[model samples]
Target chain A: MENLKKELKEKIIEALNLEDLTPEDIKDDELLFGEGLELDSIDALELIIILDKDYGIKLDDPKKGKKIFESIETMANYINENRSK
Target chain B: MKSEITHYCQIKNGKVIFDENLLYEDKEVDFQKFIKNAYQFFELDYRKFYKMDPLCKLAVMNSSVLIANLTEKLDPKTALLLTNKSACVDIDLKHQKSITEGFARPADFVYTLPNISLGEISIKNKLRSENSFFIFETFNPEFLITYTQQLIQTKKANAVLAGWVEIAENDYNALLFLVEKKKGIALKKENLLNLI
Candidate 1:
Protein backbone atom coordinates (compact mmCIF):
# COMPACT_ATOMS: atom_id res chain seq x y z
CA MET A 1 0.00 0.00 0.00
CA GLU A 2 2.81 2.43 0.76
CA ASN A 3 4.55 1.67 -2.53
CA LEU A 4 1.28 1.99 -4.46
CA LYS A 5 0.56 5.35 -2.85
CA LYS A 6 4.02 6.66 -3.83
CA GLU A 7 3.65 5.33 -7.37
CA LEU A 8 0.22 6.89 -7.69
CA LYS A 9 1.62 10.24 -6.61
CA GLU A 10 4.37 10.12 -9.24
CA LYS A 11 1.95 9.08 -11.96
CA ILE A 12 -0.52 11.80 -11.06
CA ILE A 13 2.18 14.45 -11.25
CA GLU A 14 3.41 13.20 -14.61
CA ALA A 15 -0.02 12.62 -16.14
CA LEU A 16 -1.27 16.08 -15.16
CA ASN A 17 1.99 17.86 -16.20
CA LEU A 18 2.42 19.18 -12.69
CA GLU A 19 6.01 20.19 -13.34
CA ASP A 20 6.37 22.11 -10.09
CA LEU A 21 5.25 19.20 -7.89
CA THR A 22 6.94 16.04 -6.66
CA PRO A 23 5.59 12.82 -5.15
CA GLU A 24 6.29 14.07 -1.63
CA ASP A 25 4.35 17.25 -2.28
CA ILE A 26 1.06 15.44 -2.59
CA LYS A 27 -0.45 14.39 0.75
CA ASP A 28 -2.02 10.91 0.64
CA ASP A 29 -5.38 12.25 1.82
CA GLU A 30 -5.19 15.65 0.10
CA LEU A 31 -8.26 16.57 -1.93
CA LEU A 32 -7.62 16.21 -5.63
CA PHE A 33 -10.18 18.83 -6.54
CA GLY A 34 -11.18 22.31 -5.38
CA GLU A 35 -8.68 23.55 -2.80
CA GLY A 36 -6.24 20.68 -2.72
CA LEU A 37 -4.90 19.97 -6.22
CA GLU A 38 -7.40 22.21 -7.97
CA LEU A 39 -7.74 19.79 -10.86
CA ASP A 40 -10.35 20.75 -13.43
CA SER A 41 -12.64 18.76 -15.74
CA ILE A 42 -10.00 18.11 -18.40
CA ASP A 43 -7.63 16.71 -15.79
CA ALA A 44 -10.44 14.40 -14.70
CA LEU A 45 -10.72 13.02 -18.24
CA GLU A 46 -6.96 12.54 -18.43
CA LEU A 47 -7.05 10.67 -15.09
CA ILE A 48 -9.67 8.32 -16.55
CA ILE A 49 -7.38 7.55 -19.47
CA ILE A 50 -4.49 6.98 -17.07
CA LEU A 51 -6.55 4.44 -15.14
CA ASP A 52 -7.29 2.62 -18.38
CA LYS A 53 -3.85 2.74 -19.98
CA ASP A 54 -1.61 2.28 -16.97
CA TYR A 55 -3.65 -0.11 -14.80
CA GLY A 56 -6.01 -1.66 -17.37
CA ILE A 57 -8.89 -0.52 -15.18
CA LYS A 58 -11.48 0.86 -17.56
CA LEU A 59 -14.02 3.25 -16.08
CA ASP A 60 -17.13 3.43 -18.27
CA ASP A 61 -18.75 6.41 -16.60
CA PRO A 62 -16.64 9.49 -16.11
CA LYS A 63 -18.79 10.55 -13.16
CA LYS A 64 -17.32 7.67 -11.17
CA GLY A 65 -13.91 9.29 -11.44
CA LYS A 66 -14.83 11.92 -8.84
CA LYS A 67 -15.01 9.25 -6.15
CA ILE A 68 -12.18 7.05 -7.40
CA PHE A 69 -9.74 9.92 -7.85
CA GLU A 70 -10.60 11.78 -4.68
CA SER A 71 -7.01 11.45 -3.42
CA ILE A 72 -3.79 9.51 -3.75
CA GLU A 73 -4.89 7.07 -1.05
CA THR A 74 -8.24 6.34 -2.72
CA MET A 75 -6.66 5.89 -6.15
CA ALA A 76 -3.96 3.58 -4.77
CA ASN A 77 -6.51 1.47 -2.94
CA TYR A 78 -8.79 1.17 -6.00
CA ILE A 79 -5.95 0.33 -8.38
CA ASN A 80 -4.50 -2.32 -6.05
CA GLU A 81 -7.78 -4.20 -6.05
CA ASN A 82 -8.80 -3.63 -9.70
CA ARG A 83 -5.65 -3.26 -11.80
CA SER A 84 -5.62 -6.00 -14.43
CA LYS A 85 -2.24 -5.23 -15.86
CA MET B 1 -18.44 51.80 -35.36
CA LYS B 2 -14.74 52.58 -35.35
CA SER B 3 -11.82 50.38 -34.47
CA GLU B 4 -8.02 50.58 -34.38
CA ILE B 5 -5.06 48.40 -33.54
CA THR B 6 -4.16 49.01 -29.91
CA HIS B 7 -1.30 46.54 -29.54
CA TYR B 8 0.19 43.62 -31.43
CA CYS B 9 2.74 40.82 -31.10
CA GLN B 10 4.66 38.52 -33.43
CA ILE B 11 6.68 35.39 -32.79
CA LYS B 12 8.98 34.24 -35.56
CA ASN B 13 12.57 33.13 -36.17
CA GLY B 14 12.96 32.12 -32.49
CA LYS B 15 12.07 35.52 -31.15
CA VAL B 16 9.09 37.08 -29.42
CA ILE B 17 8.74 40.64 -30.77
CA PHE B 18 5.99 42.68 -29.15
CA ASP B 19 4.81 45.97 -30.60
CA GLU B 20 7.89 46.20 -32.82
CA ASN B 21 10.29 45.55 -29.91
CA LEU B 22 12.13 42.33 -29.21
CA LEU B 23 10.99 40.90 -25.89
CA TYR B 24 12.78 37.55 -25.97
CA GLU B 25 15.43 35.91 -28.16
CA ASP B 26 16.66 32.46 -27.26
CA LYS B 27 20.21 31.32 -28.02
CA GLU B 28 19.09 27.71 -28.23
CA VAL B 29 17.97 26.63 -31.69
CA ASP B 30 15.60 24.04 -30.21
CA PHE B 31 11.95 24.99 -30.69
CA GLN B 32 10.76 23.58 -27.37
CA LYS B 33 13.57 25.24 -25.48
CA PHE B 34 12.86 28.56 -27.14
CA ILE B 35 9.22 28.35 -26.11
CA LYS B 36 10.19 27.50 -22.55
CA ASN B 37 12.61 30.42 -22.43
CA ALA B 38 9.99 32.78 -23.75
CA TYR B 39 7.47 31.58 -21.15
CA GLN B 40 10.04 32.01 -18.43
CA PHE B 41 11.17 35.43 -19.68
CA PHE B 42 7.64 36.72 -19.26
CA GLU B 43 7.32 35.22 -15.76
CA LEU B 44 3.92 33.79 -16.59
CA ASP B 45 2.37 31.45 -14.00
CA TYR B 46 -0.42 29.77 -15.93
CA ARG B 47 0.28 26.09 -15.21
CA LYS B 48 -2.07 24.75 -17.89
CA PHE B 49 0.22 26.29 -20.53
CA TYR B 50 2.73 23.48 -20.03
CA LYS B 51 0.12 20.90 -21.15
CA MET B 52 -0.92 22.60 -24.39
CA ASP B 53 0.35 21.48 -27.79
CA PRO B 54 2.83 23.68 -29.68
CA LEU B 55 0.18 25.46 -31.72
CA CYS B 56 -1.88 26.44 -28.70
CA LYS B 57 1.26 27.40 -26.84
CA LEU B 58 2.26 29.77 -29.61
CA ALA B 59 -1.17 31.40 -29.58
CA VAL B 60 -1.18 31.84 -25.83
CA MET B 61 2.34 33.24 -25.76
CA ASN B 62 1.61 35.71 -28.55
CA SER B 63 -1.67 36.91 -27.02
CA SER B 64 -0.16 37.30 -23.58
CA VAL B 65 2.27 39.89 -24.92
CA LEU B 66 -0.35 41.58 -27.10
CA ILE B 67 -2.53 42.35 -24.07
CA ALA B 68 0.23 43.05 -21.56
CA ASN B 69 0.23 46.82 -21.90
CA LEU B 70 -3.50 47.39 -21.68
CA THR B 71 -4.50 49.31 -18.54
CA GLU B 72 -8.21 48.89 -19.08
CA LYS B 73 -9.97 45.72 -18.01
CA LEU B 74 -10.44 43.16 -20.76
CA ASP B 75 -14.06 43.27 -21.77
CA PRO B 76 -15.71 39.86 -21.50
CA LYS B 77 -17.40 40.55 -24.86
CA THR B 78 -14.02 40.63 -26.61
CA ALA B 79 -14.04 38.30 -29.59
CA LEU B 80 -11.08 36.24 -30.77
CA LEU B 81 -10.55 35.41 -34.42
CA LEU B 82 -7.51 33.53 -35.63
CA THR B 83 -6.36 32.19 -39.01
CA ASN B 84 -3.77 29.60 -39.84
CA LYS B 85 -2.48 27.92 -42.98
CA SER B 86 -1.76 24.46 -41.52
CA ALA B 87 -4.63 24.41 -39.00
CA CYS B 88 -2.88 22.08 -36.52
CA VAL B 89 -1.85 19.49 -39.14
CA ASP B 90 1.46 19.06 -37.35
CA ILE B 91 -0.16 17.90 -34.14
CA ASP B 92 -2.69 15.90 -36.17
CA LEU B 93 0.10 13.85 -37.73
CA LYS B 94 1.69 13.26 -34.30
CA HIS B 95 -1.63 12.13 -32.82
CA GLN B 96 -2.12 9.82 -35.80
CA LYS B 97 1.27 8.25 -35.22
CA SER B 98 0.41 7.69 -31.57
CA ILE B 99 -2.79 5.89 -32.54
CA THR B 100 -1.02 3.78 -35.14
CA GLU B 101 1.50 2.70 -32.51
CA GLY B 102 -1.47 1.50 -30.33
CA PHE B 103 -1.07 4.20 -27.67
CA ALA B 104 -3.02 7.41 -27.91
CA ARG B 105 -2.06 10.24 -25.57
CA PRO B 106 -5.02 12.14 -24.18
CA ALA B 107 -3.04 15.38 -23.94
CA ASP B 108 -2.23 15.35 -27.66
CA PHE B 109 -5.69 14.05 -28.53
CA VAL B 110 -7.40 17.06 -26.96
CA TYR B 111 -5.52 19.51 -29.18
CA THR B 112 -6.37 17.89 -32.53
CA LEU B 113 -8.75 20.72 -33.39
CA PRO B 114 -7.37 24.10 -34.47
CA ASN B 115 -9.86 26.20 -32.48
CA ILE B 116 -8.68 24.78 -29.18
CA SER B 117 -6.18 27.64 -29.01
CA LEU B 118 -9.04 30.10 -28.82
CA GLY B 119 -10.43 28.22 -25.86
CA GLU B 120 -7.03 28.30 -24.18
CA ILE B 121 -6.79 32.04 -24.76
CA SER B 122 -10.30 32.62 -23.40
CA ILE B 123 -9.60 30.56 -20.33
CA LYS B 124 -6.36 32.40 -19.63
CA ASN B 125 -7.71 35.89 -20.22
CA LYS B 126 -11.19 35.28 -18.80
CA LEU B 127 -12.77 36.38 -22.04
CA ARG B 128 -16.23 34.85 -22.55
CA SER B 129 -17.14 36.11 -26.01
CA GLU B 130 -17.52 34.37 -29.36
CA ASN B 131 -14.31 33.10 -30.99
CA SER B 132 -13.54 31.49 -34.34
CA PHE B 133 -10.59 29.94 -36.15
CA PHE B 134 -10.36 29.98 -39.93
CA ILE B 135 -8.10 27.93 -42.18
CA PHE B 136 -6.68 29.66 -45.21
CA GLU B 137 -4.41 28.78 -48.10
CA THR B 138 -2.44 31.90 -47.18
CA PHE B 139 -2.74 34.93 -44.93
CA ASN B 140 -5.78 36.91 -46.03
CA PRO B 141 -6.10 40.31 -44.48
CA GLU B 142 -9.33 41.02 -46.32
CA PHE B 143 -11.20 38.22 -44.61
CA LEU B 144 -10.04 39.34 -41.17
CA ILE B 145 -10.93 42.94 -41.89
CA THR B 146 -14.42 42.15 -43.14
CA TYR B 147 -15.34 39.70 -40.39
CA THR B 148 -13.90 41.88 -37.63
CA GLN B 149 -15.77 44.88 -38.98
CA GLN B 150 -19.02 42.93 -39.03
CA LEU B 151 -18.57 41.83 -35.45
CA ILE B 152 -17.93 45.36 -34.22
CA GLN B 153 -20.63 47.02 -36.38
CA THR B 154 -23.26 44.54 -35.29
CA LYS B 155 -22.42 45.12 -31.61
CA LYS B 156 -21.55 41.47 -31.21
CA ALA B 157 -18.23 42.40 -29.63
CA ASN B 158 -16.67 45.47 -28.14
CA ALA B 159 -13.23 44.49 -29.40
CA VAL B 160 -11.60 41.76 -31.48
CA LEU B 161 -8.31 39.93 -31.26
CA ALA B 162 -7.61 38.71 -34.79
CA GLY B 163 -4.52 37.46 -36.57
CA TRP B 164 -2.67 34.54 -38.07
CA VAL B 165 -0.78 31.88 -36.05
CA GLU B 166 1.01 29.04 -37.85
CA ILE B 167 3.32 26.39 -36.39
CA ALA B 168 4.82 23.50 -38.35
CA GLU B 169 7.95 21.36 -38.15
CA ASN B 170 9.86 23.59 -35.71
CA ASP B 171 8.92 26.76 -37.59
CA TYR B 172 6.19 29.13 -36.39
CA ASN B 173 4.75 32.60 -37.02
CA ALA B 174 2.16 34.55 -35.08
CA LEU B 175 0.98 38.04 -36.02
CA LEU B 176 -1.86 39.08 -33.71
CA PHE B 177 -3.67 42.40 -33.24
CA LEU B 178 -6.02 43.91 -30.70
CA VAL B 179 -8.71 45.95 -32.44
CA GLU B 180 -11.00 48.12 -30.41
CA LYS B 181 -13.01 51.37 -30.75
CA LYS B 182 -10.07 53.61 -30.04
CA LYS B 183 -8.16 56.40 -31.76
CA GLY B 184 -5.32 54.92 -33.77
CA ILE B 185 -4.68 53.79 -37.31
CA ALA B 186 -8.04 53.07 -38.94
CA LEU B 187 -8.79 49.36 -39.22
CA LYS B 188 -8.06 48.59 -42.87
CA LYS B 189 -6.83 45.62 -44.84
CA GLU B 190 -3.73 47.50 -45.94
CA ASN B 191 -2.85 48.44 -42.36
CA LEU B 192 -3.25 44.86 -41.23
CA LEU B 193 -1.12 43.56 -44.07
CA ASN B 194 1.56 46.15 -43.44
CA LEU B 195 1.74 45.19 -39.77
CA ILE B 196 2.41 41.58 -40.74
Candidate 2:
Protein backbone atom coordinates (compact mmCIF):
# COMPACT_ATOMS: atom_id res chain seq x y z
CA MET A 1 0.00 0.00 0.00
CA GLU A 2 2.87 2.42 0.73
CA ASN A 3 4.45 1.70 -2.63
CA LEU A 4 1.05 1.94 -4.33
CA LYS A 5 0.37 5.39 -2.84
CA LYS A 6 3.77 6.66 -4.01
CA GLU A 7 3.12 5.30 -7.50
CA LEU A 8 -0.32 6.97 -7.54
CA LYS A 9 1.19 10.30 -6.69
CA GLU A 10 3.76 10.02 -9.48
CA LYS A 11 1.08 8.95 -11.96
CA ILE A 12 -1.18 11.82 -10.95
CA ILE A 13 1.63 14.29 -11.29
CA GLU A 14 2.63 12.99 -14.72
CA ALA A 15 -0.95 12.65 -16.04
CA LEU A 16 -1.94 16.15 -14.91
CA ASN A 17 1.38 17.69 -15.97
CA LEU A 18 1.85 19.10 -12.52
CA GLU A 19 5.32 20.03 -13.68
CA ASP A 20 6.61 21.65 -10.53
CA LEU A 21 5.39 19.01 -8.12
CA THR A 22 7.06 15.78 -7.09
CA PRO A 23 5.75 12.81 -5.13
CA GLU A 24 7.55 14.16 -2.04
CA ASP A 25 5.58 17.38 -2.34
CA ILE A 26 2.20 15.66 -2.13
CA LYS A 27 1.08 14.23 1.18
CA ASP A 28 -0.90 11.00 1.08
CA ASP A 29 -3.84 12.50 2.93
CA GLU A 30 -3.78 15.89 1.21
CA LEU A 31 -6.78 16.83 -0.86
CA LEU A 32 -6.35 16.49 -4.62
CA PHE A 33 -8.96 19.09 -5.55
CA GLY A 34 -10.43 22.32 -4.27
CA GLU A 35 -7.83 23.50 -1.72
CA GLY A 36 -4.86 21.15 -1.85
CA LEU A 37 -3.77 20.40 -5.39
CA GLU A 38 -6.42 22.82 -6.67
CA LEU A 39 -7.12 20.65 -9.67
CA ASP A 40 -10.03 21.67 -11.86
CA SER A 41 -12.61 19.77 -13.96
CA ILE A 42 -10.30 19.14 -16.88
CA ASP A 43 -7.78 17.61 -14.52
CA ALA A 44 -10.51 15.35 -13.25
CA LEU A 45 -11.04 14.02 -16.77
CA GLU A 46 -7.32 13.46 -17.11
CA LEU A 47 -7.38 11.60 -13.80
CA ILE A 48 -10.14 9.47 -15.22
CA ILE A 49 -7.87 8.59 -18.12
CA ILE A 50 -5.12 7.69 -15.69
CA LEU A 51 -7.43 5.39 -13.78
CA ASP A 52 -8.57 3.64 -16.95
CA LYS A 53 -5.21 3.30 -18.60
CA ASP A 54 -3.09 2.49 -15.57
CA TYR A 55 -5.27 0.76 -13.00
CA GLY A 56 -7.74 -0.75 -15.49
CA ILE A 57 -10.44 0.77 -13.36
CA LYS A 58 -13.34 1.96 -15.45
CA LEU A 59 -15.20 4.67 -13.59
CA ASP A 60 -18.66 4.21 -15.09
CA ASP A 61 -20.35 6.44 -12.56
CA PRO A 62 -18.94 9.91 -12.35
CA LYS A 63 -20.43 10.52 -8.87
CA LYS A 64 -18.27 7.77 -7.39
CA GLY A 65 -15.21 9.67 -8.47
CA LYS A 66 -15.86 12.36 -5.86
CA LYS A 67 -15.09 9.90 -3.09
CA ILE A 68 -12.59 7.66 -4.85
CA PHE A 69 -10.35 10.52 -5.96
CA GLU A 70 -10.45 12.38 -2.67
CA SER A 71 -6.75 11.80 -2.01
CA ILE A 72 -3.75 9.73 -2.99
CA GLU A 73 -4.46 7.28 -0.19
CA THR A 74 -8.01 6.70 -1.38
CA MET A 75 -6.91 6.23 -4.96
CA ALA A 76 -4.22 3.74 -3.99
CA ASN A 77 -6.64 1.77 -1.83
CA TYR A 78 -9.27 1.76 -4.55
CA ILE A 79 -6.71 0.49 -7.04
CA ASN A 80 -5.61 -2.20 -4.61
CA GLU A 81 -9.15 -3.55 -4.31
CA ASN A 82 -10.50 -3.09 -7.83
CA ARG A 83 -7.71 -2.75 -10.37
CA SER A 84 -7.87 -5.45 -13.04
CA LYS A 85 -4.34 -4.78 -14.20
CA MET B 1 -6.68 60.76 -25.47
CA LYS B 2 -5.20 58.33 -28.01
CA SER B 3 -4.10 54.75 -27.85
CA GLU B 4 -0.34 54.32 -27.26
CA ILE B 5 1.86 51.26 -27.17
CA THR B 6 3.39 51.27 -23.72
CA HIS B 7 5.21 47.94 -23.39
CA TYR B 8 6.00 45.47 -26.14
CA CYS B 9 7.70 42.05 -26.30
CA GLN B 10 8.73 39.91 -29.25
CA ILE B 11 9.47 36.19 -29.41
CA LYS B 12 11.21 35.02 -32.57
CA ASN B 13 14.28 33.11 -33.75
CA GLY B 14 14.57 31.66 -30.21
CA LYS B 15 15.07 35.13 -28.74
CA VAL B 16 12.71 37.05 -26.46
CA ILE B 17 13.11 40.80 -26.64
CA PHE B 18 11.19 43.47 -24.78
CA ASP B 19 11.44 47.06 -25.90
CA GLU B 20 14.45 46.08 -28.10
CA ASN B 21 16.31 44.56 -25.14
CA LEU B 22 17.08 40.86 -25.21
CA LEU B 23 15.46 39.07 -22.24
CA TYR B 24 15.75 35.38 -23.15
CA GLU B 25 16.89 33.07 -25.91
CA ASP B 26 17.08 29.36 -26.79
CA LYS B 27 19.36 28.23 -29.58
CA GLU B 28 17.49 24.95 -29.96
CA VAL B 29 14.28 27.00 -30.53
CA ASP B 30 12.00 24.13 -29.59
CA PHE B 31 8.54 25.51 -28.84
CA GLN B 32 8.03 23.56 -25.60
CA LYS B 33 11.48 24.34 -24.25
CA PHE B 34 11.21 28.04 -25.14
CA ILE B 35 7.95 28.43 -23.29
CA LYS B 36 9.21 26.42 -20.34
CA ASN B 37 12.36 28.56 -20.17
CA ALA B 38 10.30 31.75 -20.26
CA TYR B 39 8.00 30.54 -17.50
CA GLN B 40 11.02 29.61 -15.41
CA PHE B 41 12.79 32.88 -16.16
CA PHE B 42 9.73 34.85 -15.14
CA GLU B 43 9.16 32.56 -12.10
CA LEU B 44 5.47 32.26 -12.86
CA ASP B 45 3.05 31.14 -10.12
CA TYR B 46 0.17 30.23 -12.38
CA ARG B 47 -0.19 26.45 -12.27
CA LYS B 48 -2.78 26.40 -15.05
CA PHE B 49 0.09 27.21 -17.39
CA TYR B 50 1.18 23.58 -17.34
CA LYS B 51 -2.12 22.39 -18.83
CA MET B 52 -2.26 24.84 -21.72
CA ASP B 53 -1.26 23.77 -25.22
CA PRO B 54 1.61 25.37 -27.13
CA LEU B 55 -0.45 28.18 -28.67
CA CYS B 56 -1.69 29.32 -25.29
CA LYS B 57 1.80 28.88 -23.88
CA LEU B 58 3.13 31.14 -26.64
CA ALA B 59 0.50 33.74 -25.85
CA VAL B 60 1.13 33.55 -22.11
CA MET B 61 4.90 33.44 -22.49
CA ASN B 62 4.85 36.97 -23.97
CA SER B 63 1.96 38.21 -21.89
CA SER B 64 3.12 37.11 -18.40
CA VAL B 65 5.98 39.58 -18.48
CA LEU B 66 4.24 42.56 -20.12
CA ILE B 67 1.22 42.28 -17.85
CA ALA B 68 3.47 42.09 -14.78
CA ASN B 69 5.37 45.20 -15.86
CA LEU B 70 2.14 47.25 -16.08
CA THR B 71 2.62 49.36 -12.92
CA GLU B 72 0.09 52.15 -13.50
CA LYS B 73 -2.74 50.03 -12.08
CA LEU B 74 -4.92 50.25 -15.16
CA ASP B 75 -8.54 49.14 -15.26
CA PRO B 76 -9.28 45.44 -14.89
CA LYS B 77 -11.16 45.75 -18.16
CA THR B 78 -8.02 45.74 -20.28
CA ALA B 79 -8.92 44.10 -23.59
CA LEU B 80 -6.90 41.81 -25.85
CA LEU B 81 -6.84 42.11 -29.63
CA LEU B 82 -4.72 39.47 -31.32
CA THR B 83 -4.09 38.32 -34.89
CA ASN B 84 -2.63 34.95 -35.74
CA LYS B 85 -1.82 33.26 -39.03
CA SER B 86 -2.03 29.61 -38.02
CA ALA B 87 -5.07 29.87 -35.68
CA CYS B 88 -4.51 26.83 -33.44
CA VAL B 89 -3.97 24.47 -36.40
CA ASP B 90 -1.10 22.92 -34.47
CA ILE B 91 -3.35 21.66 -31.66
CA ASP B 92 -6.28 21.01 -33.97
CA LEU B 93 -4.29 18.40 -35.86
CA LYS B 94 -3.45 16.53 -32.67
CA HIS B 95 -7.03 16.83 -31.41
CA GLN B 96 -8.41 15.49 -34.71
CA LYS B 97 -6.07 12.52 -34.44
CA SER B 98 -7.07 11.88 -30.85
CA ILE B 99 -10.72 11.82 -31.86
CA THR B 100 -10.08 9.45 -34.76
CA GLU B 101 -8.03 7.05 -32.66
CA GLY B 102 -10.27 6.96 -29.59
CA PHE B 103 -11.38 9.59 -27.10
CA ALA B 104 -10.76 13.32 -27.39
CA ARG B 105 -8.61 14.60 -24.58
CA PRO B 106 -10.56 17.42 -22.94
CA ALA B 107 -7.55 19.63 -22.35
CA ASP B 108 -6.40 19.36 -25.97
CA PHE B 109 -9.94 19.63 -27.31
CA VAL B 110 -10.56 22.83 -25.35
CA TYR B 111 -7.58 24.54 -27.01
CA THR B 112 -8.45 23.55 -30.58
CA LEU B 113 -9.74 27.08 -31.20
CA PRO B 114 -7.30 29.98 -31.46
CA ASN B 115 -9.35 32.34 -29.26
CA ILE B 116 -8.63 30.17 -26.21
CA SER B 117 -5.23 31.78 -26.19
CA LEU B 118 -7.03 34.99 -25.30
CA GLY B 119 -8.74 33.16 -22.47
CA GLU B 120 -5.35 32.12 -21.09
CA ILE B 121 -4.25 35.76 -21.22
CA SER B 122 -7.45 36.88 -19.55
CA ILE B 123 -7.02 34.39 -16.76
CA LYS B 124 -3.48 35.58 -16.16
CA ASN B 125 -4.43 39.27 -16.16
CA LYS B 126 -7.88 38.89 -14.56
CA LEU B 127 -9.28 40.85 -17.51
CA ARG B 128 -13.05 41.06 -17.97
CA SER B 129 -12.95 43.26 -21.03
CA GLU B 130 -13.71 42.14 -24.57
CA ASN B 131 -11.09 39.98 -26.35
CA SER B 132 -10.76 39.02 -30.00
CA PHE B 133 -8.58 36.80 -32.22
CA PHE B 134 -8.38 37.22 -35.99
CA ILE B 135 -6.87 34.86 -38.53
CA PHE B 136 -4.92 36.45 -41.37
CA GLU B 137 -2.54 35.40 -44.10
CA THR B 138 -0.02 37.66 -42.43
CA PHE B 139 0.19 39.83 -39.33
CA ASN B 140 -2.53 42.47 -39.83
CA PRO B 141 -1.28 45.49 -37.96
CA GLU B 142 -3.82 47.67 -39.78
CA PHE B 143 -6.76 45.62 -38.59
CA LEU B 144 -5.42 45.48 -35.02
CA ILE B 145 -4.95 49.26 -34.82
CA THR B 146 -8.38 50.01 -36.32
CA TYR B 147 -10.19 47.70 -33.92
CA THR B 148 -8.16 48.77 -30.90
CA GLN B 149 -8.97 52.39 -31.63
CA GLN B 150 -12.65 51.54 -32.00
CA LEU B 151 -12.74 49.57 -28.75
CA ILE B 152 -11.04 52.30 -26.74
CA GLN B 153 -13.06 55.06 -28.41
CA THR B 154 -16.38 53.29 -27.85
CA LYS B 155 -15.59 52.46 -24.19
CA LYS B 156 -15.54 48.77 -24.98
CA ALA B 157 -12.08 48.59 -23.44
CA ASN B 158 -9.97 50.88 -21.27
CA ALA B 159 -6.73 49.45 -22.69
CA VAL B 160 -5.82 46.84 -25.26
CA LEU B 161 -3.01 44.32 -25.61
CA ALA B 162 -2.69 44.16 -29.35
CA GLY B 163 -0.29 41.85 -31.16
CA TRP B 164 0.30 38.98 -33.52
CA VAL B 165 1.10 35.34 -32.72
CA GLU B 166 1.88 33.04 -35.62
CA ILE B 167 2.74 29.40 -34.88
CA ALA B 168 3.12 26.93 -37.72
CA GLU B 169 5.60 24.32 -38.85
CA ASN B 170 7.25 24.35 -35.42
CA ASP B 171 8.15 28.01 -35.85
CA TYR B 172 6.59 30.91 -33.91
CA ASN B 173 6.64 34.71 -34.04
CA ALA B 174 4.77 36.70 -31.42
CA LEU B 175 4.62 40.39 -30.53
CA LEU B 176 2.42 41.87 -27.81
CA PHE B 177 2.09 45.50 -26.69
CA LEU B 178 -0.07 47.13 -24.07
CA VAL B 179 -2.05 50.13 -25.38
CA GLU B 180 -3.41 52.83 -23.12
CA LYS B 181 -4.99 56.22 -23.75
CA LYS B 182 -1.62 58.03 -23.74
CA LYS B 183 2.18 57.84 -23.43
CA GLY B 184 4.88 55.56 -24.91
CA ILE B 185 5.08 54.81 -28.66
CA ALA B 186 2.29 56.20 -30.80
CA LEU B 187 -0.01 53.39 -31.94
CA LYS B 188 0.65 53.97 -35.60
CA LYS B 189 0.67 51.36 -38.36
CA GLU B 190 4.18 52.29 -39.40
CA ASN B 191 5.39 52.19 -35.81
CA LEU B 192 3.84 48.78 -35.28
CA LEU B 193 5.30 47.68 -38.62
CA ASN B 194 8.75 49.07 -37.78
CA LEU B 195 8.82 47.22 -34.47
CA ILE B 196 8.26 43.98 -36.34
DockQ per model, Cα? 0.45, 0.63
lDDT of each: 0.87, 0.86
- Per residue, candidate 2 scores C-alpha lDDT tens digits across A1-85 of 9999888888888777788899999999999999999998988998898888777899999999999989998888888999999
Best by lDDT: 1
Output the number of the DockQ-best candidate.
2
Measured as a fraction from 0 to 1, the native contacts recovered by model 2 come to: 0.55
Q: lDDT score, residue B146, model 1?
A: 91
**Model 2 TM-score (2 dp):** 0.93
CA error at residue A58 for candidate 2, angstroms = 1.9
Question: For model 2, what is the C-alpha lDDT against the true structure?
Answer: 0.86
Sort candidate 1 into its docking category.
acceptable
Candidate 2 per-residue lDDT over residues B37-68, each given as its tens digit: 77888888888899888889889888877766
Tens-digit lDDT track for model 1 on B1-196? 3688877889988888877888888777776678888888897888788888889989999999778856777678999999999998877998899799877777788999999999999989988898999999888999998999899999999999999999887878899988899876777888878877
Q: Worst ten-residue run, lDDT, model 1 chain B?
A: B66-75
